[model samples]
Each structure stands twice: as C-alpha cells, then as structure tokens.
Target chain A: MSMNDLIATIKKVLEEVDVVLGWTRSPAAGVAVPARFHTPDEADGAIFDSTCTHNLAVHLPRLKNSKVGIVAKGCDARSIVQLIVEGEVSRDRIRVIGVPCPGVIDVKRAWRCFGFGKKIEDAGGRVHMEGRSMPREEILLHKCHQCQDQEPVIMDLAAGDVKSVTPPPPPDKTGIRERFAAMSIAERREFWREQFSRCIRCYACREACPLCFCRDACSMQTREPHWTGGQVNAIESEMAQQVRTSHLAGRCTGCEECERACPVGIPLMLLLEEQNRIVEELFAYRAGMSLEDKTPLLTYDVNRDGGWR
Target chain B: MPKTEVKIIGFLCNWCSYAGADMAGTARMKQPASLRVVRLPCTGRVNPLLVLKAFREGADGVLVSGCHPGDCHYNEGNYYARRRMEVLERMLPALGIDPARFHYTWVSASEGAKWADVVNEFTRRVKQVI
Candidate 1:
C-alpha cells in the first residue's frame, strides 16, 4: 500500500480511537519515525514506506488505557498479539489497522547506498536525495528478506491490497546459529566474550525493544540486590545480556531492534535467535504465534514437560 | 593433566535434599568432596543467576536436588524448579556452557544412599567435562 492510502485508512480509524500509532516521515532523510496521531488531521501526516523500520506497537503500552489505533506491520501486529496474551493490554481498548509491509528500509545500509547523505520528503518511496536512488537490494532490512508475514495476521482495516512479491530465495543460511554450531565451544565463548566486551553499558538495546516494559524499575538499574553492577566490562555486560535474553525466553518476537539500537553493533540478535530456538524445541512455542497461546516460560505442563535430561 | 579437581556447586532444598545429604553423612556413606553445598529453603529459590555465578566462579559442575514430584514441602516449588532448570539447561550450551555441567534431581529425606550416588556420579561427569 502507498503512503497516501495508508493515511486514508488511518484517517478512518481515528474516528473510533483517541490516538493512532504509526510511522511518519522523519526529518532525517531516508527514514521514518514512530508518530502518534490524536486527530484525523494529524493522521494524514503519517507515512508508510520502505524506511518505516520501527515496530510502532512499541508505543501501545504507554497508551494502553487509551483507545489507541495502530498501523501495525506484520511484526508490529504480532507484538500486539503477544502483549494481549501476556495480559499487558486488552484487545477492546486498542484498534489495529494492519498495513502491508513490503519490508522496511535498513537505515545503515541505506546510508551506504546514499553515499552517507540523503534528503527527505514526507511522501513515501524513492529516497529523493540529490539524484541518489537507493537500490532495492541495498535498502531492505535482512528481516524483510526473510519476512514470513507480508500481510498482518490480524487487522481491522487495510489501506489497500498487500503487494504480492515473492520473497527472494532464503539467504545463504550463514546465520549465527549455524556459525556458532560450527565453532568449538571454547571458540564460541571467546567470540561472545569479545563481542560483549565492546558494550559500554549503554541502554539503547533495552530502549528499542518493544516487549521490554520494565521501565524505571528495570533490574538493570536496581541497587539493592542489584541484578548487574554498573561496572563497564565484559562480564557485567554479558550478565545484563543473559538476564534480559533469558527473561525474554519465549517472548521475544525476533524483532532485532535491540541489535539495531546497540551503538557497538554487538551481535545481540544471535543470542536471541538461539534462545527462540530453545523455546521452540523445548515447549514448541514461538513468540507472537497466537493470541491464545500462553507464554511457555511463564507456564508449564506436567505431562508434556519434564526435566531437561 | 594431573587429575584437575572438578568443583561442583550443590544447591539443596532444606526440607528434603539437604536432609538427605545429612543422612548420607550420618550413615557414614562416603561421597566426593568436590561438592560445595548451598542450602536453600526450596528448590524454587535456586535462581538461574546463582548457577551462572557458580560457572563463572570456576565450578566445573552445578547440581540442584529437591523433593520428588508431588512431594514438594512447599507443595509445588520443585515442580516449578523442574521447568525453570529445564529451560535454563537447554539454553546453557548457546552461551558455550556445556549443558552436562548442570544437573537436577529429586531426592527425599530418606534417600541417603541415593544422595551419595548422585554426588559421586555428578562428580565423575564434572571430572570428565572439565
């Protein structure tokens, strides 16, 4: 669906809710920002395009009590389903306007295609910056390349028909899981140690995550019986990562925003991918699979689940 | 390698497994000295972080023992522990930590011989892993 059509749908959705959450054209060239529209006039300003990288449902929790409408991509809509399953929000309070996502633009790769600079127009598509056109191959995020859901599983209205495009052949399966499996145990440990050592204890990863609603009381910042010390080193960083990833065991939707937000480019998604696999293997559970499916980590079955052995 | 000593952290529930270990001592049952037991009120209290800390502190193995299914003194702590440890153990290998280094079992207060056997066997596995 084009940006104009998306705004038209959102404008209709705005009549039923106080505000809607969706991507708006950013001041930054070749980017989209999460925008909140309280009125239909403001709704017209929202844009849907390749650069709408954010999972806008991340804003829903803050506006949970309000009747908030959201322009959810496949992933964003799934996140909302997971949130409802976890009892974070009720379905009645929030409205969903599912939009067809052709795949969002990866900002880092887009910069490379734009030769580190670009210009912006609120209208979607074709990063119009100084006669520089970002090749389609370079702009789509890796998640988009492997995107399983082009159309949202759940939605109240669609702006227009979802684009029917064959997802490119699955990329060479050089994902971290296969790579880590090939490495020796000691080598794997050394690899993660080096990657985590580069973390400056920045909380960007935590901030970008849509599911982590811990807010000011997050364990990372606790003092009494602190979860992790303020020390800026590998062990502490590793500990923080472990606690977070484990907490998200069956809840992470594999959004990859944590890795995207990490300033140091730590391979955080690799850890989460491995974790999601374990959840699937052990509990036959996948995050955002269904609204009726309870999170496995929070509940256990006696007959189906026993000891790890 | 001159028989590098294997260190194992044993987290025992106060009601059943800890008493089971004590009975092993009173019965003069010999067990490996490799175990460093930390008694908690219930297996449910055994935080995954504690096991991670044990590994970080150079424990070659970690063992958690509690009441049998349907026999937890706190009614369902061991049941909860079973699931938690299962998830944690499955995830350990992803961090390059050998899943063999962690073990969980049910031990009743009357099972003194079983307590000795669990320790000896776990010590052997840790020795092999380290």
Candidate 2:
C-alpha cells in the first residue's frame, strides 16, 4: 500500500493503544527506521516502505504491561502470531495493524551500492537511490525472496489491501545455501569455527530476535549453569550461539533479524533456517502460524517420531 | 599427535538406564571403557545443552539413555525427551558435528544385557568416527 494508507492506519490505531510501533523516515540513514508513535499527531510521520525491515513485534514482550499497537508486515505478523502462540503477549492486549508487505530490501546492500545518507526509494519494482536504480529483485532481503507469507497471518486492522501483494519469486539456491550444502559435516565444523571466530560476542543476534524474550534469565550469558563462557574466542562464541539456536529450535520464525543485527555478519540464519526446516519436516509445524498451534518441541507423538534415530 | 581413545559421555536416566547400566557393571559384561556416565533423574532432565557441553569440553561422543517409551518413571518424560533428542540429533550435522557422534536410546531397568549391547554398539560407532 501507499505511505498515506500506512500512516492513516497507524493514526487510527494510536487512538486506542499506548503506542503504535511503526517506522519513520530517517534522514541520517536515508531509509525507514523503527519509531514509536504515542499520539495521532506523531502517527503522521509513521511510514512503511521496502526499507522498513525491523520486526516491530520484538518490542511486544518488553511492553507486555502496555496495550501496544504494532504495524506488522507479513513476516513480522508471523513473529507476532508466534509470540501470541508462546503466550508472550495476550491477544487482546495488542492491536496488529497489518501492512500488505511489498517485500523489504536489504538497506546495507542498498547503502553499499548507492552510498550512505542518500535518499532511497522503491517504485515500479525497482530501488532508486542517488539517481541510480537496481531491479527490486536484486536487493530484496533474502528472507523476502523466499517469503511465503505476503499476507499477514493475523491483524486487528488492515493498512492496505492484503491481497494486492504478490508472492516472492523462487529462491536462488546458488549462494550461501549451496555452499553450506556443498560442505561436508567436517568442513561445516571448520566453517563455523572460522565464522564464529569473527564474532565479537556482541549478542546483537539475541537482542534482535523477537522470540528470545527471556530477558535476564537467558542462558546465553548465565553463569549459574555456565552454558557458555565470557571469553571472546571461537569456541565460546559458538557455544553461546548454540544456546541461542537450541532455545529457538521450534520457535524461530526465520525473520532474519539476528543476521541483520549481527555487526560481525555471522550467517546466523543458516542455522535457524535449517532448524526451522527440520522442525517443519519432522513435526509438520511452523512456528507462529496460528494462535492455537502447539510448539513442536513442547509436545510429542507417542507412536510416530522415529526417523531421526 | 594421535588420539589414544575416544571419550563418550553417557547421560542415563536414574530409574532405568542407570539401573540397567548398574546391572551391566554387576554382570561384568565386557564393553568399551570409553563411556563416562552421568546419571540424571529422568531423560527429560537431560537438556540438549548438556550433550553440547560434553562435546565442547572435548568429549568425542555423547549418548542419552532412558526408560522405554510408555514406561518412563515419570510416565511421559521420555516422550518429551524423544522429540528434543531427535531435534538435537538432526541438528548436529548442521552444526558441523558428525551426527554419528550423538545417539539416544531406550533401556529398561530389567534389560541389563540390552544396555551392554547399546553401549558397546554406540561406543564402537563413536570410535569409528573419531
């Protein structure tokens, strides 16, 4: 939908909720950045576009005490629904203003190609920045290219015609996915060692995750059990990520926030995506698809689950 | 330098696998000396992290044994453990650990000989991979 429709919907929702979580144009970044609009007047600046990539639902659990309104794109809605499924936020406590997502682009890639602080726009299925244009397909976030949920899974209000959004093109399998598949198990271990060694132990991936709502009790940094150490070496970093990945086994919605937030650029989604696929294949479940859905790991089938053995 | 022998960590449920392992020990069944056993209250208590921690601490392999399905001391602990273990086992290869380095199985308190077989076979498989 258009920016006017997005802002109007946020404005309408702001009347009832404590704050409307949406995006606003950032002059410094030359793209949309997440903003909280507490009043209808503030909603005038709320915008949603291809550059609006943050999943605002990450704020829901932290704001559990407040009646919040969120502007969710299709993938973000999956996270919202998954959060609801996990009972992180009560259904009535939040209002989801669903935007028919036109697929968000990788702002980092855009900034790399067009230069930073240059106004970026998406029109006619092409991204334009500094008078240069690239095909929209070239810069769409990796998650968006494989997006199966163009329609929000749940919403209290629709910002635009949900059906107007088209499906993403089939994923190109030649890059990281192919490389990962090509690597043998031994090679993968070495690959992860080298990749994780570059990690600065910033924990940005955990912070950006919408499902990692465990706040102070997160085992990633806990010393009582000492799941991972504070050392910044590859082993400790890998173990820290192992804790995060295992915790997210049946729950991660493949939002790709962790990868985006990771300053060191660890391909964290490769692990999460593989786990999500395995969970789907083994249990016939996808996290956050429905409110009534049970988490695959929390439940079991007495007579059925044996192929992994 | 060449490694001398494989080190395998075994997490055995207290009610069954642990007792079965005790039975194996009392019976003097000859099995690989590679496994170091840690007993927990139930298979459900065997968090996948413990296994990962064993691996990270330089254990060559990890094994989890519990009561047979529908026969857990806590009624359904192994049922839940089954799913978690399966997910973790499948995840090992993706994490770059050889999936064969990890295993999970059922062993009842009465099945002492069976426990010997389980340990011997698993230890053998781990030795081959290492």
Candidate 3:
C-alpha cells in the first residue's frame, strides 16, 4: 500500500532468503535503480515507486545456487513464473514479494521531457517533475499502456494493496501498431532492414532479457555453427535478431526489456509482439502464465493441430 | 529485369521423402530442376532456423518433406516436426518472405509419383512468386 509496507515485507522476506532484489532511490540519477538487500537493515533502502521499472527476476536465473527474495511487479512475476516452468529456478528456493504495480513510468522518456536528473514523482494519476505535471498515461512505459496484470501472477507474500490498482486501458491502435498492421510483408522487410542497419550489435537486448539466460552458449555469437557473421552490418544484425525472435517464439513474456535495453533504439518489440500474437492465436497460450504450461513449440497435439495446416 | 532461375532447398527426411525422391529420380519422372536435396534422419532434426538460413542464403523457396503424420520411422518425429513447421510457416510472412515460398508436406517412400507431382506444383508456385 505504501513505502513502509514494501520495506517491511522485504525485511520479513530477507530472513528466509540470501538476498532480496528490489529498487533503491539513486541520488545521482534521481530515479529508482535496482539494488540487492542482504539484511533487514538494508531493506530500509528498498522502495517501490513508478520509477522502479527494472524487472528483478532477471537476476534470479544467475543466482541459481542461492535462495533469492525478489520484489516482483505484475510483469516481473510473469518472467519469474516462466523461469520456474523452464526449470531455470526452483519455485521453493525463492520468495516472491509481490508489489501490485500501478504501471511504472518510462524514466528515460520523462528525463527527455523534463531534463535529466530532475526530481520526478508519481501521484494522483500524474507524473510530477520540477513544478511541471503531466498525465501519468502520457509518460508510462509502452508495456504499461497494455498491462494485463495489475496484480502479480504468483506471490508468496503480498507487499502492497493489490486491489488499489486498476487494469491498463486498451492501447491506441495508432503509431507503431497501426503502421505495422498497414504494412505488407515486403514493406515490413524493408522497414526492418532499414531499422537494423543502425544496430551496433552491442547485445544489450540479449543481456537485458530475463529469459535469454544462455550466457556463453548463446547462438547469437557462436562461431562454430556460424549462424550470423562477426560483422556489424545490417544483414548480420538482422539475422542475429531473427535468431533471438525465433528462439523466443513461445517463451517470450513481452516484458519489452530487450527493446528497452537496446542502445541503438531498435524496435525489437515489433518482432517479438508479432510472434507472441501469432503464438497466442495458434495455440491459445500465453507464455509465463502458468507453471504447468509446456512451451507450445516443444510439444504437439497430433489430433488437434489441424487449423494451422 | 531478367528472370532468374528459382533455387529451392529441399530438406527431406531419409526414411521416406529422401527415398521417395530417389525413386522419382530412378523412375525418370519429369520434374523441375530447381530443388536441391539435403537428407536428414528425420523431420524433427529440421530446425526452423535452417529454413530461415536457406532464405538468407538466397534460396527462392524451401520445402521440408517427411513421413506422414502417423507413420514416422521414429513413430513421433514427424508429429513434433509438424508443430514446428506450422509455426515456422506462419512466421515467414512476418519476416517478409512470401508464405508461398515455403511449404512442408508428407511423402511416403513408395509415393514416387506423388513426390514428382509435389515438386512440380511447388516449383511452379515458387516460380510464380519470384
């Protein structure tokens, strides 16, 4: 319900887990940055505000050997659920402190508008910064504009008022969505080619993905199979992204971390969102929704899969 | 612009489609020369990326052929391959490849005639698109 409730919950959870992954306000950045708390005393620094946009579950897979306590927003919890279903993290070894999200703001967007490192706050469905206020809907992350889970999907401990948040409104069928729908297959090919031409191949998109936990074994950079070339040109970059999008066909949770992390600002979500939509339409399945779900691509229903043909 | 010869990459499962193609060849069945065959153990080994790679390498079309759904040599390989191919087929359009450029179908070892007909139709279809 409040900052105290979030801190108190994390403190309680810290007793049972080795580390609690949450957000702490940064003095220099003037926004919430992800931090790990090891003790009840460190939990005092934990805060859950609109600026706490980082998904803490990205840290869970790397810490497979230790018990972890994660402060999960509704979207972050989906990533955690997916990790559990994939056997990357055991559910029992981790504690989930669910924070009923009120849709986090895209702090970079805010900074771009209000000037960087300004005191930004969210209150009464609006974002406030440096004596200027704007409607919260105008500054929220694109993922938040279409958020389906205001309440965490799975939680061992509830930290905030789960009932207080309302579902996100339907997204406007304009901008990228409308333009994407209007483009033909040939046109889309050109669009993506032009877009990927600017890619520097930094691999920030891969690194920020919570589900892309392949680390050193990632095929994106593997030289043996030589999936993509070492060059940073349009063809190689586009193929690298194709590898990512195809591999994430049924597993991506639409967290948009990959797009957000991309330094060159490639709209990676366009490919991912399209694949997610196709997966849902064909199989009637949404990734990371349940622990029992086998990835649709990994399994088959011989008698029932006729419509796709 | 001058018309280019359509180059199709055919990934055939060894037990059925590959043998079926061999039979067609030995029978001297008249078919287009567009398709080049790569034989794999089963359709299950036909990863979707292989299809994409074929396209990237300038294959005008890709055809994956295996045993009929209930008749895989491995009993279940084609069943799994069926789902993957279906998914990959749906994704082609999104990647800007004409959906008509890729196809997957079943061809039993004895169906030499059927294999010839499939190759004729698919190559004709690919020629139309390119």
Best by lDDT: 2
Candidates in descending DockQ order: 2, 3, 1
Error of 1 at B78 (Å): 2.4
Kindly give the stretch of ten consecutive residues in candidate 2 chain A with the minimal lDDT sum.
Answer: A165-174
User: lDDT tens digits, residues A23-107, model 1?
Assistant: 7766655467788898888887788766677887677778767898888888777788888888887889888887766666667
**Which candidate number has the best DockQ?**
2
Model 2, residue A102: what's the lDDT?
Answer: 79
Task: Considering the two chains of model 2, state its CAPRI-style docking category.
Answer: high
Q: Write model 2 residue lDDT over A266-307, tens digit each, in one string.
A: 899999999999899899998889998999888888778765
Model 1's CAPRI class? Answer: medium
Candidate 1 chain B has its poorest 10 consecutive residues by lDDT at B1-10
Model 2 alpha-carbon miss at residue A159, Å: 1.1
lDDT at A195, model 1: 90
> How much DockQ does model 1 earn?
0.62
DockQ of each: 0.62, 0.81, 0.72
lDDT of model 1 at position A307: 41
B47: Cα error in model 2, Å: 0.6
Q: At residue A68, what lDDT does model 2 achieve?
A: 93
